[model samples]
Target chain A: EIVEALIRGAGPSSLEGVRVLLTAGPTREPVDPVRFLGNRSSGRMGYALAESLADLGARVVLVSGPTALSMPRVHERIGVETALEMHAAVMSRVADCDLFVATAAVADYRPERPADGKIKKSAEGLTLRLVRNPDILSEVAALDPAPFTVGFAAETERVADYALGKLRDKRLDMIAANLVGGERGGFERDENALSVFWPEGSRDLPMMSKTRLAAELAALIAERYRERHAAST
Target chain B: EIVEALIRGAGPSSLEGVRVLLTAGPTREPVDPVRFLGNRSSGRMGYALAESLADLGARVVLVSGPTALSMPRVHERIGVETALEMHAAVMSRVADCDLFVATAAVADYRPERPADGKIKKSAEGLTLRLVRNPDILSEVAALDPAPFTVGFAAETERVADYALGKLRDKRLDMIAANLVGGERGGFERDENALSVFWPEGSRDLPMMSKTRLAAELAALIAERYRERHAAST
Candidate 1:
């Protein structure tokens, strides 16, 4: 049992000396000084991945948004805010990486113009112009030196079909799909369930701790990374 | 614009009075007075669903596990701790529901004998005896008055194969699949990616807030529920 676990833990030799880049948490799109658009992301999942990657002896760069969580050990932690900042930080370091994972809940759209002062609500309803934010994963995957890019798909329906489309449309090497229905495990909760899809095969890890799932995903990513690397070579 | 939004929301008249029962958050299995095996599940998804179901005027019963978040408006909330407690609660109420969604991260195994007293540290490593916990979704689906059941498959790889298998094997009407990996969002994060699959058609909701996804899912569930109901009649 110990030996089997060890084998599973170590993964393949190709995983050695690889570099991993991950983005985590939620991006805050400012509407006003007092109010901003943000999700319930706590950054726990990203922290778990950073720890898991480090445990596997991979050099990891964890680019995080504003999160209350502490930084994981044995990795380079870059903190930023807004989707633009995250995209810049990731782009600066992505060239030197071997694997790229985008886990941040980046705002798909942002206020077109920032309110110079906090807007006091009128008796009438208010309206604010919005513009699309940067597509970080799609941008990275489109790069010439694109590392094995992985994207995340959070859907409520037709998760697999959409994931496959993203995998093809975004040109991602793989995608991790999840259902967002229950409040606890999907966001700001400590546990999660994941369905990972790749070009060849996919597997289910069931519902487990973000910590345990992160480690399991790291092992599988290493394995798949090696397989893809070998086939390309 | 409000009227237009309402019209967009009320796509046809097929989903008027659906009733839904959902489970969310993590279940704790106690081993001692102060110690228990539990994951970090926040219950955001289920609360979001409850909120959406209410918005669509569906009578909703949300059987939840322990969490810090407040209950979503317009739904009945029943909180539980142990798996057995959750099982009993779900079984008691599941029969009348028109749709059932299971998103709770229930523990797969529990300590065989929960120690009454905290074990003192010794030189030898501690060993624990574990027993399998009941599959809540499967059990509910097997019931005579089983509602339109939806289960979640969180996998690391082989997502579709495993998810579709579960949809058939567990006899679920549909399964929401998620892949857990580096940070973007899964398990305690703010956003999630989902792939919802059934025997025929499937769709995907891209990474978004669990709240928004829940609204979309509730809509889909309501539509599917009506279709299934009509087919049976």
Candidate 2:
């Protein structure tokens, strides 16, 4: 049994029979019928992750926000535009999965009141009141018999510290953190680096193409997931 | 001279030697390093116009906002992110153009004080103060030796009245109005209809592909431009 577990963690079929529910892309919070408050996520990293996990024989269900990317080959894909819709979609499928990854840059807040029609340019200055959106990752992690929940944090400063804080505060199984707003290796780019953290230890993934990075991250996740399963069983 | 002018308006080389400046896509207003306020323009119509005008032998200089579309074949293409950047690019080149078409859906307002870093999700509610961006079309039309200025109006209600209002108020030579926010034929769609209004007359362009619409609009613009030039000199 020990040898089988070791082989499973190192092989391509490491995640075979594991079910994953993942979210990707940036959610657009509507300010009106035409305008929206959005972020700069291109969804490449998350899409790559989905593909990598599926290559390991995992059944992946992708809950995606508005993006120009074509659908990745997964068990299912649910398209969503806003944070609320994505939240609903994810919650509906969370129960059936052994793992959940929240990689989408979901809006932290949305306009308190979105205009039905296009808002006219009548005001010299406009003040928009924004209400906080639900914390999808925290909620999923807190579920009874929760899956191994992993979250992504894109920060401009203190990348590792913030990622660790989120992992602890949200009671998540793991967190992958990256620095954004720099000249390279973040949002809108095809390459990135990650500082991955869990309760026990952390790993630094050097800068590389998102495809290669996803494969590396998937391997780490499979190993950790198998270890936890072995200990629990 | 009359026969020459008539043939010029009807032929493919109608705009031979004409210098055209056009703007396309939707401007993004930064709320922070990560978040932005944006609209739903696909930049298809403006790109189509650039292609059509270039086919008619015009030297097209396109000032474009960030979009997913590839570069259209034109004499020059200036890519911009914010409304202020777009305004600067257009103003710098306006003096050299014979015609200016504003197809971009520039943001009406931008966050007054954008944060240098990503705003944390600590606050339950937040208020964003927004200030109006420069009216690029009006400023260009107000230039001393302004090009034959044309504007596009996307309205949710009273399309004709608002379009006529814009033409008269802005002192524009022509305005093309289209209805948006419906189930079909606006913003992100490839097909659209236009109600084009000038000082003395109006023309209704029924629903068609943006490519066909651009060709028709270019012909009308060429005819009107020739008439205006003949009357002037």
Candidate 3:
């Protein structure tokens, strides 16, 4: 199996000292204690990423939103909810990391004024005031000593075009694309398909199990990281 | 929510009917009763697509492989394993579809001889015969009456270059790219980020819940599908 082969390739002593930072799951924007805006993100993809990175022998720091996924082995796991909390967590320790990945479905907009308690339901139509959340990926990418930064683009049409624009706009080193709309294989599904892209080129990992993809992705990341590092040095 | 705003913008009842075909998850190639080869895919992204399509009032046909996700409510659902199975399933019914998305992660290789029973482990490391699997996306794209085809790429580096390469090699109408690393977001995590690309331009979804991204992707897909359809006609 490729997993077995990959394990062998790493040897017992390989990847012992690598460091990585990752974010996972969905962020909640509270409108009231009983009401909040959120998306249906299970954090599975982020969990799998952490596992794969750990397997590669990287000491990982996982900053997560609320998710059912168990903490991956070999990582410092921190849990948070709101986008602000995530931002704080990420910023606090982003330095000294070799890689940074932002996978959390962070709420782009949050209620400007969160109600202290359950909002009373009235006959009148409710209007909400929202403000934009911080752009986590962009913020990290703009860092002085940014680790290899990667972003993702999940689009329905003009997937390639839009993704490339994001890479340039966000100033990301790379990006991934997810095509939603399938039967049993999208959000909340156990399988997925990914397309990876960079400024110069791109490749498709096709659809596969997330676990396997994570491993392959980790190896590829290691190789690329080394190449970029080598080139810079 | 953006959904409410979009629907309102479309003028309630404007989208009574539409059709879409989406592929999701990762194909598996069996080597024995206990062993099979597959890609790392969580199917979350595709499921998100289905959800967004449904929300937009499209009657969706979702073709998928094995995944842990529940099937999004749709007009039709077909499930299969292996690339060959998925290829047959897609070809059997793709003729009438209005839009086609090749999102499933199909195995590139399969064991030539799948053991009827679990193969006994031998003292010496055994080499299993391998063969190439059919490229389902490319095959469908080559169809005489091809539906609007969209392809995906998951790469570690040079995402744009590689994605563009796939666009040419596979002859796809569009492509999306995702880089896998950091957290579990790429494969199994609920939240994901994306970069949408095509021949013309690109955009970045940034990090967000797959569900939210799915909605945006669907809107874009629907818009582009209409444009492409109109151009062809």
Candidate 4:
């Protein structure tokens, strides 16, 4: 009821003519011809956000990694694999988008040099040399005329502190923090809860289907975006 | 054409009344509440095997990991996550199966103690302590009345030597070896090739859709199985 009211209050045109860019799913960093580093992101939340944002009249450009999700109803969808590919995709189009959402659960590292052939298994085991992946959100935040950036911190522990740290460190305008796993919500689940925070204010969103949560978040983001735009003007 | 003939040569009773246990897809080993160790095994080949085996009159019990593919037409489909879960699921049913196919890309190691809550990200980085998971195929091979086991070696390099070594070391009745990744084959692609190896014989299966490949492989396994049974009798 609370979230529904929030959505109803925003009205359309809150994001009319606004262009939004979103990232979703887990990036695959190849270890060899057959293997790769990946996370357990199902891309549901991100897809929902794309749909909700589009519903609010934003032209959504979705850059997604490997997932089973059908394409969201959006202006465009750019498919990618590794973090490097995603970084390239997002940076090339940042200047055209008004609001940016980073919902992807990107791997932090990739094999420094993926083998041309499969590595043979040894009884003693094998070790991989991994290198850090570029932080996409951080890069976007550093842009000269950056979009209104909202990032996600899907944490299992110490949710608030970490989310806040990312908001400050990455210079994000807002961050949505959530816990994954368990019956109520998490990876691959249909329902979720979020704690949204900005520099000066915060709101706790109760557990709900990713669809409804996205609708509410889209509305809230639109309101904040319009307020910031008006103040700047 | 050769592969099609191979399937045509096998009679309908090739695997009749055979209770086959198969494992497919890639296991998820949790690192934290929101993160896990996973690989990209689409379960395409395994699902194909299940369908083909069922068509040959085997009672197929498929234990699979997380995948985007739909359930194969088989006697039963048991979904699981993590190496531990897969191990347990396969072992519990080993008593009832006459033949076993180990196709799942089970993670060799898993986080020793996955965090109950999401781990906080630090600029410094994060490390996980992983422990070796039980070798499902090895354990099944050691069973008192072991099923005639077939294993898979999905390799990028040294495919033959490694697969043969596993065939002998694990006491497997047969092993299917394949190279992953390229224009015509490997992960996510619809087609593949395999080198089938047994104790004293080998057969090279050329590139084809996983559907056709599964049919040929199923026929070969059934023939080998019947021959072994006849000799024993």
Model 4 residue B200 CA deviation (Å) reads 3.5
Off by over 4 Å in 2: A1-13, B1-13
Q: Which is the leading candidate under DockQ? A: 2
Residue B103 lDDT in candidate 3: 74
Scoring only the second chain, what is candidate 2's TM-score?
0.95
Model 1 chain B is weakest, by summed lDDT over 10 consecutive residues, at B117-126
lDDT tens readout by residue for model 2, B93-177: 9999999999999999999999998999998999999999999999999999889999999998899999999999999999999
Query: In every candidate, what fraction of the native interface contacts is reproduced?
Result: 0.00, 0.88, 0.00, 0.41
lDDT tens readout by residue for model 1, A1-233: 99987776555633558898999987876654323545556778778877787777888889998787876884689998788899899989999999999988776656677665444332232444557777899999999978999887766557688888889889998898876544536666789988999988888878899999988887788778888877899
| lDDT (tens digit, per residue) of candidate 3 on A1-233 | 99987776665433457778889887866655433555556788878877887887789899999776776774699999889999999999889688887778776666678776434333233445567777888899999978888776655456688778889988887787776434534456788777787777787777788877777666666666666776899
- Expressed as tens digits, the lDDT of each residue in B111-227 for candidate 3 is 677766434322222444556777788888898878778887765456678788888878787887776544636766778777777667677777888888778777777666666
The DockQ scores of all candidates, in the order shown, are 0.01, 0.86, 0.01, 0.41
Question: What TM-score, to 2 decimals, does candidate 3 have?
Answer: 0.49
Model 4 misplaced stretches (Cα beyond 4 Å): A1-13, A123-130, B1-13, B123-130
Report i-RMS for every model: 24.5, 0.7, 25.5, 3.1
Model 2: per-residue lDDT, tens digit, A36-108? 9999999999999999999888899999998899989899999999999999999899999999999999999
- Supply the TM-score for candidate 4: 0.90
Lowest-lDDT window of 10 residues in candidate 1 chain A?
Answer: A117-126
Which scores higher on TM-score, 1 or 2?
2
What is the CAPRI rating of model 3's predicted complex? incorrect
lDDT of 2: 0.93
